[model samples]
Target: MGKTPLHLAVTGPSSVVASWILEKDLGLIRIEDVLGRTPLHYCASAANFDLLLKQGASVNHVDKRGMAALHGVCYLGASDLVACLLKWKPRLDLRDKTYGTPLHCGVISGSIDVVMALVEKGAPLNAADANGNTAVHVAAKLGRHNILRLLIQQGADISLQNTNGRDPEAIALDAAGNVGILSILKHKRQDSPESQSILNIVDEDTKASSLDNQVTGNDSPDFLWDEDSMGAAEQNELMGLSQSANDDLYTYEEQQEYCSTTFPKPAPESQSNNGFGKAAFCLPR
Candidate 1:
């Protein structure tokens, strides 16, 4: 509630007014509201956010909740705002009071773009929150199949367990019986380099035996292939299986409905509250 004129101007609809306020008193950029959020923390508009950064706003400033501007932008799924913050090189792994990194916030916001940006900027994918749940665990528990797949592809540790001793796969199964999510998790584990190496060893052993059988003119076939082994075609099918299942599970409109119904966006008034918004801090702990 103690926001300065600069805070109001930056978050206001007009970027010109914000520029005017900055010109009048550049030090206002460093002023903190009652919640400890500087003007940068409330700059939802990418233009305004960039203006504050160029004007020397601190991207590292945290609100009372221990969330920096980067954390808030990531939670809002504002890729544009995120890009502005990234240029300033903020601490990507800065932990909020809830022990969540920006990667965790991005995952919960359901924006793959935000998640990818943070990942590309070197955010810790396997950073565990207070509950020992990584971004992978949160995505699984929330039935975010696409996000989970991205996390897996980005080298997130799927085997990490939470306080309840539940891994990502276990959490996925508990999330409304999300078999699609479970399948993706299992596929990731199976496709690991270690797993592939073991499988290759077994395949070579079997292939050698088949060659010996063929040389001895045994009744068995000249070549024996393990049905369990995945070929190029099988790999392609497996890759597409999740997408096909997702199509069957949720259409574009239905996905929008699901996200809205499950995680409604905060009201406009709430966006400028002491914290960024309820959604910004409502992440699973």
Candidate 2:
């Protein structure tokens, strides 16, 4: 890992020793390990992380995985560490290898506080990842009802679709079968000002067409929701859309396992500021 003494001292058992190492040589603050992780990148202790920052540690340095310290802390749901990083004004919307912003990581970690902090700080809410899935898509796909609600309240676009053309509503229904999430999205879309404006326009257009049809005595039949209305090919196409939505999602068990291994719960309060353990190296997937 090519960890220097400064890296070891900060992530080690003693914050006092880490401070001593920093005081001895400030240049160690900028040193990178074999993985290109600076001492700031490995400093899990909020106090130690702050100390390095005060000594001019670079917060924007990305490791081999194209992740900065903000990415790891957000994924770990470490609100304190996240707070420290935010004070430095690190790039709010920096994209990782997967093109996911820090807000996406916070949502994946299932930490409302982390998500709130990012949102309050003005992180881009609608930025999509490489797969065209925005924060809304991720929250819905993972069955995060509360997170989905928060994102919606903060003005995340619910109608945005992913690479497979499945929006959050379809993802909630087909991928997770989350009725609550679907209801929230549906209600937001219907009540949104944009949707209301579109509805009004559509209403006006319909009224004009109805008057024209009445004057011309047009007797063409309109499509209805009957068994004969949809052809075999259209039915097959609808079935394919549902199947594709399901195929694009991970199974519930798989999602749980991924969260467990990829974003370990924050360290206990007793160990919170001690050092980095499983929470330090959350690489982008």
Candidate 3:
């Protein structure tokens, strides 16, 4: 025989060799045959963690990707294996050699269950990789609507922009073709009135700045608003719209009062000393 039935079991062949090994002898294979997989990887990939784990397989061993059994279980959507992995206290923050975390995998798979599992297990929903991409950005780019909702609900940074100067919403709107995803992205705003007020201010400034640039023959206005600023403004507007649409949205009570008051509020503390009508517009936050 070229290889023993137990060896075939390790190879993941469908030769019923695992059963033969179990029948041939108990504990016949040393723990080392469990290999980098710890049997959990094979079981998870095969959807049979229960039996494999019952036979004393480890749950935290890193595979070739530096992912533990829990990581594998996440992609497999193995609920039981996940529970078992949680019981074992597998490192929730375990990152692959490439710095990819379980949350990254969850977002890519579009599996909300895996997302919730990792989140409940203390996985950082806002954790960014070397590329500064959060789970929200991943979900949005992939158009994972439900996953995006779960992430936003958990307070993922809706405003965090990537190096490419695009926030989650911008990416989602560009890549997301699903109406459901767009609908979810439509509602992750943090401040409506404040954002709207800022945009109105920006628009007025833009027009004035345009005229100033034209008259002065200056190609660049004072701190000309770049694409990044425009995207930030747009993000703020979306957040504002989202908050206004949902009654359950939370806004600062002070801002609410100011927005509702008939009288014009005083200039921001930063602009109080400035000349009349010079309300700190264009000042960097």
Candidate 4:
């Protein structure tokens, strides 16, 4: 029994000696085996599409998965191989069983060349997959900001919502993509500068309140200073001074003695409970 041509091509090499064996000695290998690609599938998956194509591989051949060689190239976003496949004019609109066309695969890969090549080749841009996700949706979900921008420019619906009720901004935020998307959205709304100015005013008010609290030794509700912070040490010194300022705790007689010794005041005309005078004490004769 002759070995199948696919088996020979897969195991055989592109070397002159091996080619002679398959071509001259065997004569069993068919052109279809080389084009149908039992070998190209393995090569393309391994990113060896260049070698397979050089070894007389067909660009239009579909694997068992219903994916053409071009589809594989698009998945890898290999511009060179994609260009070669485009040159061959393979069926660009060919979709797999899941309605995943080459254009779908190209967008998922997020390569400009792959997408542009498919678009140029007349691949339908608005087609959605089983999940009703257009290429723009996929790009947004993956947080491919530039790719999303490109799709938008190409008439992709930025407002289109997926089945989960999420729009592009929500998806990008969920994915934590670059803050550039947030800035873009803010710019579109034209309210970013106003919001920023309001925030600055609030922040300045907070700072002013904090400074007043520091000068008055009053702890602001918002400014909780940790015991280990330098601010706490400074606060403790101020609190000590405040504690010394509480003169109401001293006795009235002790205060009068303190005042007399400290200030050498003149004797009062009479010691009495006069409402107009400071409390006085009679000294012992």
**Residues 97-132, model 4: lDDT tens digits:** 332567767766778888887877777666655445
| TM-score of candidate 3 against the unseen true structure | 0.52
**lDDT for each residue of candidate 2 in 189-283, tens digit (9 for 90 to 100):** 67565554322322355643432333233232111111335564543332111234342233323433543574444336634554554322222
Tens-place lDDT per residue, model 1, 65-174, is 67787877777688888887898899987877553788887987789999989999899988877657789977886778788888888888888866655677655554
For all predicted structures, in order, the TM-scores are: 0.65, 0.64, 0.52, 0.47
> CA RMSD for every model?
17.3, 14.8, 27.4, 39.2
Winner on TM-score between 2 and 4 is 2
> Residue 46 in candidate 3 has what lDDT?
40
Worst 10 residues of 1 by lDDT: 217-226
What is the model-wide C-alpha lDDT for candidate 4?
0.47
The superposed Cα distance between candidate 3 and the true structure at residue 104, in angstroms, equals 2.0
lDDT tens per residue, model 3, 102-167 = 687667656787788888878987776544567787777677878887888887777776545456
Report the Cα lDDT for residue 225, model 2.
Answer: 12
Stretches of candidate 4 above 4 Å error? 1-37, 43-61, 97-99, 161-167, 181-285
For each candidate in the order shown, give its overall lDDT on alpha carbons: 0.65, 0.65, 0.50, 0.47
**By summed lDDT, which 10 consecutive residues of candidate 3 come out lowest?**
276-285
Model 4, position 247: C-alpha lDDT score: 35
Scored by lDDT, model 1 comes in at 0.65
Full candidate order by lDDT, most accurate first: 2, 1, 3, 4
